[model samples]
Structures are given as C-alpha cells and as structure tokens.
Target: MQRFQGSPRSVLSTLLLVLVMGLLLYPGLKNIAVYLFSAITGNYISGTHSVVFLSCPNEQVGKVIARTIVEKKLAACVSILPKVFSIYNWDSEITETTEVLMVLKTRTSKIHRLTEFISGSRVE
Candidate 1:
C-alpha cells in the first residue's frame, strides 16, 4: 500500500511539472513564432493588396511603366529584372527573345489604370 501511494504521488508530481513548464514557455514560444512569421510574410493583413506582374518589351519600356506607376502613386514598389529570355508564339510564329520583366507591386484597385497605361506604352 505504501509503495503504491508513493508511485502515484511521483506520477502526479511529474505531470504537474510538465504543466508548469508548458505554462512558463508558451508565451515566449508564441512571441518567437510571431516574430519569425512576420519577418517572412512581410506583415500581411486581411483586405490588403496584391502585386501585379507586368512585362515590357525592353528595359526602356519597363522603366516607363515603373515610373508612371510610382509617379501616380499607384504602387508601393516596382522591381525590374532586365534581360529575360521569353519563348512564345506570336503572329503564328515561335519566337525566342530577351525582354525586361517588371514586377509591379501596385494595389489591386489600380490594376485597370495600370493595365491601360502599360498597353498604351507598348514599344514593340
């Protein structure tokens, strides 16, 4: 009877210790996770915006698109990658060519205007 009672008490102590440790570490662990997620995800919130990928025929054309978006305050940022080779069919012919890729980080609301502006500025 004495041995049985001691074993139960030891098990209870171990469970209680685990519970206390969990309680103590939870807040710290949660904060660490939040920090890591924020660092990786760029502080996204519900109802925020998405970026648009706009391509231009050349660096000159891409720069024009980027400048217009920024000057109009339609975008927060525009990252341009030049000299990308694009392989596609145009006018019933397969074409392999180099072009500039502009990642236009604009709000969804300005997509229509941005598209119109980009379409009008095509230099091909």
Candidate 2:
C-alpha cells in the first residue's frame, strides 16, 4: 500500500464533498435541511396548517362528512380511510369496531369551524 500523500486541505475538501453528497442523496437529511431552512426563513409557520382526524362508523358517513367539509371550505382536503379497526373503552365497557378514518387538512384558522360542523353533523 502506498503512503497517503494528500494535504490537509485536500482531505478536508474530500470530506466536505462527501457530506454534501450524502445530504443530497439521503431523504431524511434532505428533509431536515429543508425544514431548518424553512424555519429559519419564516416560510414555514407553525400552527398555520392543521390535520384533524375523525372516526366515522361507515364509509357513507365518512364520505358525507368529507364532502360537507370540502363544500363548506372548512377543509382543503379530507381523506377517507376505510376499514380502520378501533378498540377502546367507553362507559366502562370495551368496544371493538371497524371504523372509517377521516383525515382533514385545513388552515388552522378553520379548525374551530370544522370541529363545530363535525359535532353538529355527528351521525350517531
């Protein structure tokens, strides 16, 4: 094996190049960097957006709620996920049931209205 002949500056440059490549190639690191940049620049404001989760007894209920939310501009999007199994305690009893999960994405300012609408539109 020949003796290494690179200078300190060259070695550091190579190490930095590798680090930059890693940051570009790895998704997790890239996301962290982007998040930091956005945070520092005030481009990503916390509490500006909200994700609300609602459980529905069936797909029809989920669809109805989703549609109403979108139509009323309470949420920008509502994703209805079906066949979600839930086990929980209610009134001192364990209840197990399949439920539809609704994920609502909306502005934080609209969260209160969205929640009120959901409460008033409860299927039960």
Candidate 3:
C-alpha cells in the first residue's frame, strides 16, 4: 500500500495551483457582460445597420466590390445580381444596356469606408 503525505507546503501549493487555474479560466468582463445580456434578452448581437446598392459595369467588377466589402468587414453580406437591364439617358442619348448590381448590408458607421472601397475598386 502507498502512503500519502499531507503537509502545509503541499496544501499551499495545491491552493496556488487552483488560484492560477481560476485566473486562467476566467472569462473577460466585457465578454461576460455581453453573454449575460444576450442570455437575459434572448437576442444575439446584430452588428451595424445599413444597406448600400451599387452598380458596376461588369460581373467581374461586381465580384471584386463584393470581395472587398467582405474582406474589410465593411459589410456583413453582399448580394450580387448580374445582367440587370437598365435604360438611362446620357449625353442626350437614351441608352439601354446590361449591368451588374451589388446590394451590400453593413453597419451605418461603415458606409463611408464601403464607399471608398467600392470607388477605389476595379470599376469603370
């Protein structure tokens, strides 16, 4: 049979280990607050509230815009609807053509950033 040793030093070491583990396992205060709020309200965070509609000359450009939006987190989602028929007057001439449409949903705070990204993207 093996004999166990119970000493003050051993007890102190076990308590220190438990304290360290508790500190390590403790969740962040902000995260705990968010979790508690969501738990009580039964609603998860739905960040940002805005939607932007843009048109690009081609499907390729539309995809580029969409990719940039998602990569930058400027928008949560982008819906690309391509080959849209449109008629508009330009230079005193009525023009009918097909274009790609990009509908982006993002935070209102990120609208300017989204605009900059779209404007700077590969579009003509």
Candidate 4:
C-alpha cells in the first residue's frame, strides 16, 4: 500500500478551503464568520446601542417606567419581566423581595436622559 504525504502549506490550504466551504454551506455560521472577519479586519458593525436594566417594586411601576421611556423616545424597546426575586443588603440589613425587571434597549446617546428620567421617577 502506498502512503500519501502532504506539505504543511498544502495541509493549511486544504483546511482553509474546508473552513470556507463549511461557512458557505451552513447558514447559521454566517454570523460567526462575519464576527471573525470583523475582528480580523477591524471593521466592526457599529451601532450606539445600549441595554439598561432597572428593577421596579412591582409590575405597575415597571409598566409605568417602560411606557414613559418609550414615549419619551429614551428607549426603543422595553422588556418587562414581572417576577424577579432579589436578595440584597439595604440599611445594613438583608432584604428579600419580588421585583419587576425592566430591560431597556436604547442608543448610547440617550443613556444619560434615560438614567435621569428613571432616577427622577424613583419613589421615596
């Protein structure tokens, strides 16, 4: 039986060919390929997007905050999660409570305004 031998350069070329073929054949790999390409080329897909997380005392408060931010255009979208069990230290004591979580998606340029609005809406 004859054995086949390949040079390192040929092996690398074969591997690269396989990788390109795999990327082309698999649709799900498109995102990964784009990300790797971006990293290698230093050509990032740019957007000034930001995600902010806020915890509210209850669903009503969460809804109010969400509606206000969206209405004011401070956030493009707000996702409200109704039940989040949080444990934290307040006033040197441990506190446990069920809270609503708000995830706000907005432009980084509006983060300052969004923060100001949320802080001003806090209940004493």
Best by TM-score: 2
Candidate 1 yields a Cα-based lDDT of 0.78
Model 2 misplaced regions, further than 4 Å: 1-44
Per-residue error for 99 in candidate 3, Å, reads 0.7
Error of 3 at 78 (Å): 0.7
lDDT of 3 by residue, 1-124 (tens): 9876789899899999999987886766555676667669876555426778888788988887788779889998999998999899999999999999889887666898878876676654
Between 1 and 3, whose lDDT is larger? 3
lDDT of 1 by residue, 5-95 (tens): 4688899998999999999999889766765675598885433457787767889878877887799887889999989989999999999
TM for candidate 3 is 0.58
**Pairs that clash in candidate 4:** none
Candidate 2 TM-score to native: 0.63
Model 2: per-residue Cα lDDT over 8-110, one tens digit each: 9999999999999987789877656766776588685665678999999999988888898899999989999999999999999999999999999987779
In order, the Cα lDDT scores of the candidates are 0.78, 0.86, 0.80, 0.84
My TM-score estimates for the predictions, one after another, are 0.58, 0.63, 0.58, 0.61
Off by over 4 Å in 3: 1-48
lDDT score of residue 112 within candidate 1: 80
Lowest lDDT 10-residue stretch of candidate 3: 42-51
Q: Which window of ten consecutive residues has the lowest lDDT sum in model 1?
A: 44-53
